[model samples]
Each structure stands twice: as structure tokens, then as C-alpha cells.
Target: NLTTNISPLMLMVMSLERYVAVCYPLRHASIITIKNTTLSIIASWTVSLLNNLTRCLFLLQFSLEKLETLLVKDYCYDINWFPDSLRERYDKAYTCLVIISAGLAVISSYTGVVLAARSASTDKVSALKARKTLLLHLVHLGLSLSSTVYHPLLMALSTLVTRIVFVWVQDVFYVIIIILPRCLTSHIYGLNDKTIRPVLLYHLCGQLKISVKPGPC
Candidate 1:
């Protein structure tokens, strides 16, 4: 679960980078050059790795021998040994941090996209394309927010089956959040822009190649 959680956060950071590059080309080029963008990506990944590692440290502090003895097949670490209040406090803090950060990212990105689209410098075709891209990102932004919001409610819900169903639904929605932006940006921007043509083709060919691959990694 730690590994899985990290991917979404990394992707969110990538999406933010994309929004900056697309919507604020002039400023982005000046401030977020290739080297800076690469550094940002590395930083996001590093932070996520450290966050997961911190969770592991907590696991080490609390012994897991009993959980191992119980034969729980899939759990990477035991949480039950921690006091419920302590667990809930961590949960609340994590949820709040993610929600606020993601929300601000979405707002900033969306506003930038909107301003870019409305600019007098943007021609008709470019404006239309930018709007389409913004819409695609907005869908993803909404889903990301919904998933974060749903998580705490899912935890607080009384019924076990309801919680299970809620989590599964959120998981599927989260997958969509990962995939939709990639497809939309790659294809939609690639259609008209000579610069993004390679990116479009890359994602397209990549998808086809994955389709033919033997099995899931």
C-alpha cells in the first residue's frame, strides 16, 4: 500500500508540472526549465520515498512479531498494535495535508489554464484546444479531491461491507485519475502541435506496446 500510494502523489506532481508547462509557456520556460523540471520530479519522488520510509520506521518502533505470527498474508506492516487514537491522529494529519495540497494545486493549475485560454494572444484553435485540455484536467482534479475526501468517510463508516465497497470504488476512480490525464494531454495536444507530436506518439505507441506485453509487471 505504501508503494501504491506513492505513485499517485508522484503522478499528481507530474500533472502539476504539465499544467505549468502548458499554460504558462513563457514563465515556465524561464523558471521551470528542463533541468528544474527534472529536479522537481526527482524531489517529488524522493519525498514520497522518504514518507514511505517514515511509515516503515513507525512499524519498526512498534513490534510486528504478533502480526507475523497471526498469518496475515498481504499486510506489509502491522497497524493494530498502535493505539486507535494515535492511528486516527496520523490519519487525520495525512488526510488534511494531502487534501489541502492537492486542492491548492488544482486551483492554481485550473486558474492558470483558464487564464491561458482567455488570453488575447491565444488564437482560436489554440484556445479551443487549451479549453479541452483544461476540461480533461478538471475531471481528474475533481476525482482526486473526491478520493481524498471519501477516504476519511470510508474509515469512519460503521459497516464493514460499506467500507469495503467504498474503498474499492475509490481505488477504481483513482486509477482513472492516473490514466485519463495522460491520454488526454498526449493525444489532444499532439493532434495539432508539432512540438508535442512525439509525446503523443510516444504515449500512443507505449500503450500499444503494453497491450501486447505478456503479463502485468
Candidate 2:
């Protein structure tokens, strides 16, 4: 009932696009062939829609008030309608499926970019910039994985001092990794203006007229 209108179809389209770009770089357009892409896109939506529909249908049969009264409201489901063991297996299977799909896409995309870079011909400065961009994306991917894996672990050990220290360290590392680069870049470019000091000082001195009156001097 509370459909947030989130379409899992978009994820499929994105995954297929990446798959084409990586697996068929030279003939991506040809191999992913418009027709095939459309089919894959449609299939992805159909599958996701069906999955959600089934879950909703199953849930609809149960009374929410009754379900909420259970001790483990989040984990508890109607075992009579769907066995507890079966539900657990389904959860594990879907979790593994998502992890594999996302992991493969990240790996495939990185491999494709690395291979493409090797075949590229560029000047030193331009090449360095390109490599830096690629490395930044890879690092971002690693951070995402670290956050997902460590999030629950951190929550579980929140009471322990050592765990608290580790969690904070990880958070700080993530913040630095994301923020330090931009700060460094700004400083590097800001230093390039040779007249910056003089110009700033001149403005601060207020020697120039404030121009309170409309008439020119």
C-alpha cells in the first residue's frame, strides 16, 4: 500500500548499460543491440514487479496489527503461510544475488576502464588527470562496500570501546578520503594567482572610494 513509487527497473537499465560498456567495449552498440537492450530492460522490470507483487500479495493476507504484535516484528512472518526456513532462505538468496550483481558491475566497469586506458594515447598531464579520475571512482566504490559491510558490525559492537574507536576511525577515513582531495585541489589552483596577495590587501585597505554619492568625482 505504501508504494514509494521506487522503480527497480532503473537499476536493471543501469546494470545492462554497464555490462554492455564493459563486456563489449568495441561493439557495445552492436552487441547490446538496441533490441536486446530493450528486452533486457523489460525483463528486469517484469521480474522486479513480479517479485514485489508476490511479496505484497502474501503480506496482504496477514493483518498488520497481528504481525506487529509479534516479538520480532521485523523478522516474524506467517510461518503457516510461508515457512520460516523458506523465508530465511529466500532472504539469503536475494541478498547474495544483489551483492553479486553489484560487485560484478563494479569489477567489470573498472576492468574495462583500465583496459581502455592502456590502449589510450595522451600527454602526461592529461593522462595523469584521467588516471586520477579513475582511481577516485575506484576508491569511492571501495568506500561504499566498506560502509555496507561495516555498518552492521559497528552497530553490533557499539557498546565496546574498541569497536567505537574502530567505527570512528573508519568514519574519519571516509570523510578525509572524500573531502581532502577537493580541499587540496582548491588550494593548488588558489595558489596560481601571483597577484592574489596584493589584490586582497588592496581591497582590504579601503583606499579606493566607497562611492556613497551617485555623482562621479
Please, what are the lDDT tens digits per residue for candidate 2 over residues 79-190?
Answer: 3344235544664575466556655654555555555456544233433333443344344344333433333444454545574586676577556544443343322222
Name the runs in model 2 displaced over 4 angstroms: 1-26, 54-85, 121-217
lDDT of 2 at 157: 45
Q: In model 1, how large is the Cα lDDT of residue 141?
A: 51
Which candidate number has the best TM-score? 1
TM-scores vs. true structure, each candidate: 0.58, 0.40
Per-prediction tally of clashes:
0, 0
Q: Which structure among the candidates has the greatest lDDT?
A: 1
